[model samples]
Target: MALIITDECINCDVCEPECPNGAISQGDEIYVIEPDLCTECVGHFETSQCVEVCPVDCIITDPDNTETEEQLRAKYERITSDNG
Candidate 1:
């Protein structure tokens, strides 16, 4: 599943750069995760990089965008290929 930044976010700006898929960005209020680009760090790390660096623990799995590990991997591959 993609991760979503909750209103509890402090906007500390730590999670944006940590996202390997460039999915996290500054929203009107807090940071937002683009579900299309998020891979939950599947191709880049053992765990979610954003979740790792978040100070307030405001990041959580987006139930609305639920995806399996295999699906995340496929999305990662697709994103990398588009960039490469």
Candidate 2:
């Protein structure tokens, strides 16, 4: 599943740089994770870097954008290939 930054985000600016997929960005109010670009760091790390660094713990799995581990891996591959 992709991750979503909830309204609880404090916008401390820590999560943005930690996202390997560049999925986290400063939204009008809080940091937002783009579902298309979010793989939950499947190929890049054992855990989601943004979530690890977020102080407020506002980031959570996006139930609305759920995907299996295999799907996330595929997405990671696709994203890396596109950027490579």
Candidate 3:
């Protein structure tokens, strides 16, 4: 599954830079995670970097995306491609 940022986010900015996919961003009052871009750090890291770095534990799985490992890899490829 992709990662999500809950309302509990303190806007502490801990999780933003840790996201290799650039899926995390600053929102109006807190941080947000882009489901389409979030890969749970599949190809880049062993686990969800945002979730680990979030100070308030506000980053959680985005149940709606529910991506498989292959799909996450595809997303990772796409993200890196765009980043280049």
Tens-place lDDT per residue, model 3, 1-84, is: 888888998888788889887788898888888888889999898888887877788777787879889999998998888888
Error of model 3, residue 65, in angstroms: 1.2
Q: Which window of ten consecutive residues has the lowest lDDT sum in model 2?
A: 17-26
Worst 10 residues of 3 by lDDT: 52-61
Please give each candidate's TM-score: 0.98, 0.98, 0.90
Which lDDT values do the candidates have, in the order given? 0.93, 0.95, 0.85
Judged by whole-model lDDT over C-alpha atoms, candidate 3 comes out at 0.85
Error of 3 at 47 (Å): 0.9
User: For model 1, how does the per-residue alpha-carbon lDDT over 4-79 read when each residue is reduced to its tens digit?
Assistant: 9999999999999989888999999988999999999999899998899888999999999999999999999999
What are the runs in model 1 whose C-alpha is more than 4 Å off? none
Q: After superposition, how far is residue 54 of candidate 2 from its true place, in Å?
A: 0.7
What's the ranking of the predictions by lDDT, best on top?
2, 1, 3
The residue ranges of model 2 lying beyond 4 angstroms of the native Cα positions read: none
Best by lDDT: 2
- Supply candidate 2's per-residue lDDT for 32: 97
- Residue pairs with backbone overlap in model 2: none
